[model samples]
Target: MISLRNVTLRRGTKVLLDAASVTVNPGEKVGLVGRNGAGKSSLFALLAGNLHEDGGEFLLPPSWRLAQVAQDMPETEDSATDFVIAGDSRLMAAEAEVKAAEAAGDGERMAYAYTALHDAGAHDAQARAQALILGLGFKTTELNHPVNSFSGGWRMRLQLARALMCPSDLLLLDEPTNHLDLDALVWLESWLKRYEGTMIVISHDREFLDAVTNVTLHIDVGRLTRYGGNYSTFEETRAQQLELQQAAYDKQQEKIAHLTSFITRFKAKATKAKQAQSRVKALERMEKLAPVLASAEFTFEFKEPANLPNPMLVLGDVDCGYAPAEDAAAGAMPTVIVRKATHTVSAGQRIGILGANGQGKSTLVKTIARTLAPLSGIVTEGKGLSIGYFAQQELDVLRPQDNPLEHMVRLAKEALPEGESGREQDLRTYLGAFNFSGDMVKQAVGTMSGGEKARLVLAMLVWQRPNLLLLDEPTNHLDLATREALSVALNEFEGTVMLVSHDRALLRAVCDEFWLVSRGSLAPFDGDLDDYQQFLLDEAKRVREAIKESQKEARAAAAPVLAPAARKSSSNLKALQRDLGKLEQQMLELQTQKNAMEARLSTLSDPQEIGELGLKMQTIDESLADIEDRWLAISEEIEALSS
Candidate 1:
């Protein structure tokens, strides 16, 4: 659907893309992978026709329609659903025209309206729209809520849903999964798997790329290379290729050294002069292989303080939730969201918080960090409990007006020992470890992207050298490469870590125990996320089978009691029996629908999709209400006979 032929893009003096060519076939999912500032977003812009390339051509079929999830959406007074529905403006406009024509009572115009409506599938549009809304995860109530109330992260989801709703031949998604929770990510993966059109996604999520994409297109050093297969496969192949290149470069160097030595020794000898001259000519003509740059080394070494307590932080019978100070006079409680969960964090304990969205993960983190008070719970701090809390939304603490160097200098002054020499040098060294080196340290934090800000926060936290670290969604904005670096750092740290993250891969890599926050309760899992997921699935299956078996037995037990009444008073008995049968049928259908809805909900992974499913399940609840009403009437009738 889209192809780039010898494309070269330059931003000022920097060559972002140099003679890069790539072909994306229809219905293919391609992952665009590279380091930060490697021009992944720039490439997307070029293909999206939003940016003009300096050289070569970007080709697309004439009929191909392209849609991109815009980085920044225009401010509007619309609701989340309203924003999404706006994406179908063309269809809406056509419908409006049709309505106007119908109102005018013009036969010719009305006929045209009819044709347009039929062609556009106007009759089925409502159903499709509802399905899409539900699939993206918006509660029916939330669908009408104003978009202005949503955070920037939620706004991004709205944009993604709108992009998905558009009828396009090619979709270019940049960091599409950044704001998505685990459920939403999974749902998006499933949707992309079944997507009929082409997709070129720019993501730092390794698992997401591996699950959704069939091809990997890497951009590095103003060049592009395509590998056939998923992200893991691409990594393996890329590593092998790099190894081969290094070996070849090494062999060439050895040959050149040997030839240079021979030339130096035989320069004055008449017989060997000709051989020396030939070697010199060969050396001059040899194409020098580009030297490979080593990956940035990130080492996090913390000196453990003596006299540390067994429990770093403790919460006993604690209630944790967000409470607005302004609403305190309105008799607003702390929500008591996390109820009396006696939790302990000790040295060397790596805990991972696992749950659905809005389950009070962030609230719990705040309570442990002592940023918020827990209502009616004993929250005690252990001796020498030096805590470094990294809030999910706390990147705002970094002054945008200050450059990286200024921030680093301030942090160093505040965090370093009283008389430590080379403080500025230490700040430089710390920033360098986080990939901010030389001139980059001079860039304003205001101009930095979300990923960069996240890295900076981590770097700052490491510099503090706290014994207890409280991190919330640390991996949210991080790219794959940076996330790996963090994972390595976290694993090597000797201090205690309590983290709430949606990244399963990172959790598995770093966490030792799982803390599940579900239904206002915090339950500790002695295993990983994968194990917890498996346990949930197994429990759900058991519940389903139990419900089915109980229903079957109930029906069988009622059959014999109704058989004799049918023979004695035929008409009346038949009427009663029919009513009972209808009730049972209604109950069965409702139960079946509930099961199906639950199964569908289980299949959904995206937050939006889960939200949509919740809305759908709400609609199905009406059917459940009807079933319950009938079931109650039938139960009363059945009980009368037993009396």
Candidate 2:
């Protein structure tokens, strides 16, 4: 358990926290929410002991271990697996001590070594490490790959896995879901749900927070407020509180106005001078209400060119994935990672692509954007169509040395004709619309944060004002407020949009159709993400029933042999058979739990709930599959022994 008491944190001229207090209890999952510049990361640093607070103290149990995943991963030359394995230094040290004792052949020391190893769970550490690696989206082949080979996004995933693997009493995560795809996000959600230790997550992903957290900690205007529910519930309660505050302030203001009017009307009247003077005194003593700041206005307008055809983009028999080697056999068919994919986007369609990580969602987006060439499919462009592509790697296109304004100018030149009208004005207006104004526009792109770069990329895309927009993980680094603003802007935009993102809430808000890209195929859900979630639940149930039946058949096939063994060695064989029966019953219980979860999933319409349900279903399916496999193997062994 950890507590912050009267903590005050200052960053240069800004006061991030003033007399802020928060408590994280054992097994408590807290979601930290604030504006981008409100110093959520700074607070995490203070808690992690990476930074000292200007005032007050953070109290923790003397033996409590804490780990934080920083936003910026330090540059390292080690391999990804090596970096993660380093997290178990304590366990490794214990192992070394045990080895030393073994070499000496001291019975007492050897006994101590065994105890130490057992206490540290060293035997199972490798298994846990492997699971963490897989959960974080690293392939087995890539585990030993050098860290330098990965991009920033992949490096962030490595850091996340490292943080998660560290044995700690409390974990502090700063935007841990920023770089994860849907599959990784789902895995993380499930892991956190079953995690026994405490966790404090700082994230802008609404669905992620809702899925993993039970409490919400909100930092607004140097004040901290705790809500005892998920993000959506907290948001609703906060809205109600704000409305009540505004209403009270309005009533106070009306009373004050009436008193002032009375004083002004009667100040000169001799008979009423005393009352007027008393009213003036009361007015002077009254504390003025703090003016409520207006929410930032986010307005986006797309200057539509000529109308395009009904189908904005079309792919026929598309094979979307990374291109193969150029010097390969000339007549060989390109291996289709995503095969027989044919889809059409209309001029007014708002479509979202949904699938697990490494399932070719990004590949499809890139192919549609024309950033990558399809292996063998015909990609047809609609008549008079102009596409605006916002790739996940858009930040790479920015010049490190160029300032934001300079970058905008370069992009404008590339997008505009030679003598376009009001190009500079358009850039300024677009930048302002995205909340970059004054000196922020002059900051160097290299010095900007990930969120800032993402905003700039979005601004550039809006300036182009294409009729069809292709956005891939556009809200990756955006804060909650920014995401809401984006949702509003996208809802207002008249042009068509095709987006690939793991933020289910954003998808539900902005997309009218769901494009399920999975297992090298594409299926369209004409409704919203809610409909897609129901479909997934139904599919999971069908898979579960099929697996259950397969397991039953295997058990039936081995039953006759077990019966003969039971007659020969009644006691021992009956015990073993009872054990197997118990295991089978447990598996059935797990399957029943899975079906219940599926039913609950079907009834939910909230994206956050759906995401959580999807994760639970996946975890249940994996466990059920493992149990069935184990049972089948045991049945085979029993049959072989009987023979």
Candidate 3:
């Protein structure tokens, strides 16, 4: 359990938390949420013991093991797997004892050390570490690669994996999904559901909070409030509270007006002078109620496209990827990701691109945007085709040293007709619509936050009024309000849209269809998100089974010196097959239930009801995962024996 009673925390002159109190019970999963710069990170720092409260008591079990993602990027030569494994301090200690005992040649000591190692699960630690790394989107082949070989984003993912690897009684994760793709986010959600400990996560993703957290802890206006249930519940409850507060304020204002009016009208009359004085005294004694101050909300709409082009783009026998450098001294071939993709993107189509990381989703998007040329095919565009591309890496399109006004000016100069470039004042007004005003309009892009940069890009896109929008992870850096605004704008826009996003809310709101990019093929997926999830699960199973088969064949090829009993017996094979069949049947039932629950969840509006359904769905997912693990273990045993 953790307790913060009347906690007053400050950094220099700013008060992050003032007289804020919250008690988080053991085993409770809490979602810490607030607007950006509302002291969310400061509270996390306080919990991590990097800061101390200026007043009141902050207490937790002294012996509890706490795990948190490291903020610093590690530069080390250790393999990724080794770095993750090192997070388990207890396991490492146990292994060290085992090695020490063996060196000393003490039989009794060695037996005790081996028991400790087994109890620590040191024997399968590598396998568990590998699973964490894989779930975080690292390739299996990269598991043994040096940690420093990864890019900055991948290194941050490594830090997340290491934090998850540590065995903890309390875990704190801040913006863990910021660096993850849709597939990795899904995997992390499932993994967190299986964590049987107290967890506090700070994230801006509403759907993710609803999925993984049961309690909500909000920091606002230098105070803390705890709400039962998930983020949706908290939101509903807060809205109701605000409504009541507003009503009370209005009632108080009415009384004040009546009293003041009576005093003004009757004060001069001799008979009523005494009553007016009494009224004045009463008014002075009344407690004042402050009006509710709502957070600022902004909305902007995209301008209508100048022309609507039917069959906006056609990809015939398209191979999308990078072309080899013509100046290469050695033999080099073009790296193709999507092979011979033949498709037509029609006008007014709202298509969502779906794929795992490293798949061809981005490659195909780049090809359509004409940022990357097709390797060996024709990419024909309509006569009036115009494109607005929002790249995943924002800096790729934005100049870090340029201000918002400057970027908008550059965009107008390049995109407008020969003599129709908009005036500088109009461009400034347009930038103002995206919340860049006064000095902010002149602020350099390098000094702005991610959300600000995203807004600037969107401002530029909307100003050009392109007929087609190719957005890749547009919601990655957007806050909830901005994401909602973007969804509304996309829904209202008449342009064709091809979106690649991990934000489920935005996807559900804007996308009308989905295209799957996998295994070097691009094709339409005739199903919803639920079906896609099931497909991913089934594909994973098939891949694992294929790997097992390959291993079995390899063992058989080397079986000349093996004993005959090592081979599978008829009875053993029959029993294993029976067990597998039973597990599959159970899994099918769970999958059906899961899909049904998901469908119901989509139609649900009540926060409490949605929370309940989410929990049920999470339970079903955990059960399904457990059954899959069992099936894999049993199949592996059968394969080893049969080989």
lDDT of 1 at 554: 68
User: Runs in model 2 with CA error above 4 Å?
Assistant: 70-85, 100-107, 140-151, 244-306, 326-335, 419-426, 525-635, 639-643
- In the range 1-643, model 1's lDDT, one tens digit per residue, is 5778899998779999999998888889999988778899888877777789899998879878777887785577786666776665456766787679657755445445544554665545555554455444454456667778777877778888888877778888998877776645655776788888889998878778888999999998999989999987887676546546666466446545755776798778874454355446444422231111123223233344443566787789888876667846777655677888798777667788876556678888888888888876798888888888899787888999888878878776676688653467777877887778988898989889888888788877776778887888887777766676566456545577788776766676667678888779998876766676565555445644775667656653554354434334333644656766776787688778778866776565665555555555546666766555545445544555545
Which residue pairs show collisions in model 2? Answer: none
Per-model TM values vs. the true structure: 0.74, 0.74, 0.77
lDDT of 3 by residue, 258-332 (tens): 668878997898755544654565454322211211232456767878887878989999999998888975878
Off by over 4 Å in 1: 103-109, 118-140, 245-308, 327-330, 416-422, 531-643
Count of backbone collisions in candidate 1? 13
TM-score of 2: 0.74
- Cα-based lDDT for every prediction: 0.70, 0.73, 0.81
Q: Can you list the residue pairs that collide in candidate 3?
A: none
- Cα lDDT for residue 564, candidate 2: 46
Model 3 regions lying over 4 Å from their true place: 95-115, 241-297, 327-331, 417-423, 554-643
